[model samples]
Target: MDSEKRNQNYNTYVEAKVPKTKFWQALLKAFVVGGLICCVGQLFYDLYAYWFPTLSEAQLGSAMLSTIIAITAILTGLGIFDWIGAFAGAGSVIPITGFANSIVSPSMEFKKEGIIFGICVKMFSIAGPVIVCGVVGSVLAGLIYLII
Candidate 1:
């Protein structure tokens, strides 16, 4: 067979093997999972507020963030985050938990190598860019606000 015909035949075979996607079903799953994660964060916020009635709103929010990050890191270490990510898809990715998973996942995976070269190095590989962008963006925003 000529190269053109062979390439066409290969493409056809690959397309045929592709699985059918259920758009609505996936969207529904993502919405539910994402909402649940948010609810959990809210619950922590409420608990913190109740327990520390004198705390400021910002302090309460920080506590909630810490709780969520701890929970996400623990789940990632336990290998449960993978299953959650597989099911939730974008739902999981949109939240802070997903960021926790990104940091913890690589560290856990590379811990076998060593602490300094493996866990520490790999830990920030994924999240480093995000932190950098976030910091730079905030700085730029501050500068713009000051200028205006």
Candidate 2:
């Protein structure tokens, strides 16, 4: 009787728990969200290339970079990119420009707190460690390889 009650309790407990996140759902979200971003980027790339056909491949690449930056800035300014970022965490943030949004959004939040410590300093809090550790590790690895 006790075992039967415990089993019933266990089943009820398990049922009450939140369902685990499925890979397919995440994958689908990533695909749809990320692809939408890439599609827009592709359209802009085509537009820029069409508008400036005389530019060399390197120049075109630079122009693409600038155009993407402009688009991201506009999206960030309009408060849409962050919403997209919230929905598509890795999907949105994997792009180079997403990092720009990540950095800028913090700065925007801290704008009222003054420039040095509030805006500039707080802005890089997330990015700072990534940059610092990356550079330091790269330098250390290079030094070790060079010595060996």
Candidate 3:
């Protein structure tokens, strides 16, 4: 048999072995999990506002964001966040906690190679593109606003 024919047969066999995904089941799981995360954030926001009444609205917002980021980093370090991400799919990635997880996961992964090169370098590998895009997108938005 020709090499091309053998490759084609192998590809067909692999395709047959792949499992089918249920769209509705995944969608429901993602919705529930993501909603739960958001609910937790809302709780934190309320708690902070109640506990520190003197804080301005901006301060409370920052506090809530920091709290969520810290919790997500701790979860990522303990290896629980990945499971959440797996179940939540894009739902998990849409939140601020997801950004925290993205940074911490790589840092933990490369910690074994030493802090300077491994942790620091790999830590930003995933987040660098996101930061760049955020800055570029904001600049473009600002330019458009000025033009209008």
Candidate 4:
């Protein structure tokens, strides 16, 4: 009975300390940030298309994605991306930039440990599972299509 009371008290304390979520505000922020990221990608795509008029659509897309990833990596290194992520929540997390940030962040955090174990290894810690799942899913989808 004493342990039960202590547990109940702890639960109440934790509940009181938790911040309240503002659902609509979060949704709006996410929508705006995500939309802005997509707009930036589109702008890059347009610029690339204009600069390399002879390039195919796939090439233009690849260039645009590369630009976004580079920008995201730079921003993550500078520590600006974390601030944006904190303020925007999932707003900053649903885009390709977020994936870039995930890869860069762990590497930056662990860089002091050394290049091989720290930067190179930790760089993929968050992204490794995601990459694996993406590859597996794609292969499965391709196999299903072939079967069908």
Candidate 5:
């Protein structure tokens, strides 16, 4: 067969083997899962507020975020977060838990390489850009605010 015909045939075969996605179903799952994660964060915030009545709102928020991140890291280490991510897709990915997972997952995977070169280095492989962008963006925003 000629190269053009052979390429067309291969493309057809690949298309036939690909599974069809249920777009709406995936959207619904993502929405529900994301909402549930947010609700859990809110629950933590409420509990913290109740327990530490003298704490400021910012302090309560920090505690809640820390709790969520810690829980997400533990779950990722245990392999449960992978299942949740597979089911919820972007739902589980758009939250702070996803950031926690991004950091912990790589560190866990590279644990065999030792602390310095493996776990510590790889720990921020995925989240490093995110942290950088966030810091840079905040700085720019602060500068803009000051200028105005």
Candidate 6:
């Protein structure tokens, strides 16, 4: 029952087996993943254009972003999006949908723990700095371009 005795029963000498990683596996994952994500966006774009015949191409693109964000957030709320996320992996993580997923996923997960500390902290865990740095980087790049 002692701590030392409990520790002695642990499998300390067990070897860790690494899964076979291959370049082709990764390349295939990226191709299928990236294509699927883009394909879904395309489908949504087409649907929006079909439903709203008056929308311009630019307007359709904006609507697609809004629709993706809304659907991703709703799915996050219902816990269905995570399943799609698991299969899609990087596939579901390249567009505004990914942004919505990133934000909504953490908030939903953390909400079970508590509101303030759990939800708020985890909400900005990954995407916040990315968003911040992206804006700052764009501004810097724009300035440099203007200067030269």
Whose TM-score is greatest here? 4
TM-score of each: 0.84, 0.72, 0.85, 0.86, 0.84, 0.72
lDDT of 2 at 92: 79
1 or 2, greater by TM-score: 1
Error of 2 at 23 (Å): 2.3
Candidate lDDT values, in order = 0.94, 0.80, 0.91, 0.92, 0.96, 0.80
lDDT tens digits by residue: candidate 1, 66-118 = 99999999998888999999998989988999899999999988999899999
Cα error, residue 43 of model 3, in Å, equals: 0.6
- lDDT tens digits, residue span 1-148, model 6: 8978767655343323444557676566757876876788899999998999999999999988787789789988888877876666666777676788889888877898798889998997868988899999999999999999
The sequence of per-residue lDDT tens digits that candidate 5 reaches over residues 112-135 is: 999999999999999999999999
lDDT string, candidate 3, 4-71, tens digits: 99999999999999998988998998889889888988898899989989999899888988999999
User: Over the stretch 45-130, how does candidate 2's per-residue lDDT look in tens digits?
Assistant: 77877998887877876777777777777788889887888777678777767777867788888989999878988898776777
RMSD of each: 2.7, 5.7, 2.6, 2.4, 2.8, 6.3
**Pairs that collide, model 2:** none
Winner on TM-score (1 vs 3): 3
Q: Identify the runs in model 4 with alpha carbons over 4 angstroms from their true place.
A: 1-18
